[model samples]
Target: MADLAMPEIALLGTSADPPTLGHQALLEGLLQHFGQVATWASDNPMKRHGAALDQRCELLKTLVESIADPRLQLAQDLSSPFAIATLERAKQRWPDRRLCFVVGSDLARQIPSWKDAQRLLEQCVLVIVSREGWPLEQADLQILRRIGASPRMLPMSVPGTASSQVRRRQTTEQLPKCLLPLVLKHNLYGFNTTNP
Candidate 1:
């Protein structure tokens, strides 16, 4: 058999309110293919009041504790104003590794609108996992190609869950078990959700 090669991959996610089992599943997948998996939480400008930066960072730490792999380290803040610049910094930090940016199909579809989308493509290879009901349009695909993103789809089913849905029903009796700890730690439900 030919030797197995480990791809250098980095996973980025938002523990915006809290991370659910689906997020854990994604990270597990990343650890399988990459030699090193660095995870970063997003400080999305659009999300007005999910969790503060420090709290979100703390929740990420809590969620990562369950993972057994040492390769998964906390990625520095990538939620800066210039996403492409942040990606460039990440490339420099991991000079010995082949950097790959991992995201869900929901976010993948909106790649064209991202800040400096072309520069982001030039800095890192994008690996987008499938999310159910998130239609991948030809226009977006063309845009990704134009930006030099070698997009590859992961063979996995999308978990029909989202932070929005979770926040909407915060008062429900039972919360998602996997994300309960994170939710409680960050006081996720305490935030005002007038805007996502």
Candidate 2:
């Protein structure tokens, strides 16, 4: 069992193909609630990424740096497609701290189908942040609770800008300014120098 007295650390893993204003807002919001927030860019097994894992990591790193908060860190080492594996790695890194796995409302419904999900839920507290379009349903929360996950809803409002929308639009308007140079340099997400 995790030590309840220990400091709570928020662990966020996302497919940050091109970290957007929304991602930055989410991290900033997390900082206001949690003592420490560790985030990383990872490959989602269910989705096809527009950028490579390394590139995505670089993009996320840039965003984390832009936040300029000591408590917020880009933990690329914890990147893993499987939540269980990421949770295990986090346990190894922060042996004494309580880990809270952070997810968006869009992903909250898919937790049960993940590999070793029960074990993952049992190990860490699940924190769900509501997205603009994806609303969390009572049925979903009940399902998560039934499977041993003590899910908590984060009251932060994140911008609706999504990576898929950015990719489809192929514009830099939705991306953070800090990430624009990297996106332009690599030409990721079909964004070019001419794109405003």
Note the residue pairs that clash in candidate 1. Answer: none
Error of 2 at 51 (Å): 0.4
**Residue-wise C-alpha lDDT for candidate 2, range 1-196, written one tens digit per residue:** 5978999999999999778898999999999999999999999999999999999999999899988999999999999989999999999999988999999999989999999999999999999999898989999999999999989898897888899888998877788999988888988887777764
- Per lDDT, the best of the predicted structures is 2
lDDT of 1 by residue, 145-182 (tens): 88788787777755746666666666423333545555
Measured with C-alpha atoms, the lDDT of residue 58 in candidate 1 is: 66
Return the TM-score for each candidate structure. 0.81, 0.98
lDDT of 2: 0.92
Backbone clash total for model 1 is 0
CA lDDT scores, all candidates in order: 0.66, 0.92
Off by over 4 Å in 2: none
